[model samples]
Target: MRNILTFLQESNDTAGAAHLLKTSAAPVTGSSGLSGKEIFAQTCVACHSADGKGAFPGVPDFTDKNGRLSKPDSELFKHVMGGFQSPGSPMAMPPKGGNTSLTDTDIQNVIKYLHEEFGS
Candidate 1:
């Protein structure tokens, strides 16, 4: 019975190895071991656009030569996590860029992506 169980486990491992070899999984990249560009597209592009250019009138264009990320990382992090709920601006940055589940590391990774794609 033990030998049978061992054989089954080995077979499962071999099948998994074969599947991994046959299938394609893009390697993780960028800071935080995630695709920052992909996360931005999924979470931020609604306001920041695919190229990090702000789409709405109130949203600040990240691609601008003078953008918010040019500020210190601390400032950017506060804005992203706490959100901007000031008066006169209809759209405030939702906490954690609206993904409340994102960790500080994830937010930092997004900031890194912004620096790479938009910052001077």
Candidate 2:
């Protein structure tokens, strides 16, 4: 509990998370690692916005429990990597959430960002 809160309060969780997401088992060129905040700005902020409220109609408020970190990491990865086509969403999540070039690590990093930003 104390540890969790301390971890959350630290600034690097987002960077750690993004680093986890961007790297692949095989190192690749042109790969740039980002912090959680950077990942959010580059990828999620467009739809989710800075305040964590979604900009699009179907986009959920990140501050809400139903948003990105609400699900398991694997599930979020699937939704982010494959794209969301669920009913009421109107918009597709797009492969890698529109970052088609993102590695699995990148997705994980973004998930980490979400967890840090929205999870309890």
Candidate 3:
């Protein structure tokens, strides 16, 4: 696992391997209390993009006022934790954005970041 992580980091694909390590059931420690922004950069930027404009067609544009950010936190949290298929769109959000290692708090922090950074 360490070698895989090293290789991913060297190849600038840190998120892929990090997601694998993070989703494992083993307890994760020494995270340096990463803030929501840092967490998003590390875990979400690959698909969501740095500006919250999703990288693919079906991925929601978070910066859009009429987009997913309009939903309440409860709804958003559920979607983030359990995954969601947006109506009329082919995109499907994987549970925990495909990172099961994230705690509820981590998800909440990301939600907060989304509202603060992209909410209209």
Best-fitting candidate, scored by TM-score = 3
lDDT (0 to 1) per candidate: 0.61, 0.60, 0.70
Q: Could you tell me the TM-score of candidate 1?
A: 0.66
TM-score of the candidate numbered 2? 0.67
lDDT of 3 by residue, 11-114 (tens): 46555546546543323343246677877776666557779997545668999998889988999999988887777654456677656567888888988999
Candidate 2 lDDT for residue 57? 62
Q: Using lDDT as the measure, name the better of candidate 1 and candidate 2.
A: 1
lDDT of 2 by residue, 20-94 (tens): 344332222232486666766666655566788775566777788765567678887888878776577645555
Write the number of the candidate with greater TM-score, choosing between 1 and 2: 2
List runs of model 1 lying over 4 Å from the truth: 1-33, 85-88
* Residue 26 error, candidate 2, Å: 26
Indicate the worst ten consecutive residues by lDDT in candidate 2: 1-10
What are the clash counts of all predictions, listed in order?
A: 0, 6, 0
TM-score, structure 3 vs. true: 0.70
Write one digit per residue (lDDT tens) for candidate 1, span 2-120. 22123324645443234334433333233244566766765566556566666445667777676676788888888888876435544466666556556788888888888998876
lDDT of 3: 0.70
The regions of model 3 sitting more than 4 angstroms off are 1-32
Candidates 1 and 3 compared: the better one by TM-score is 3
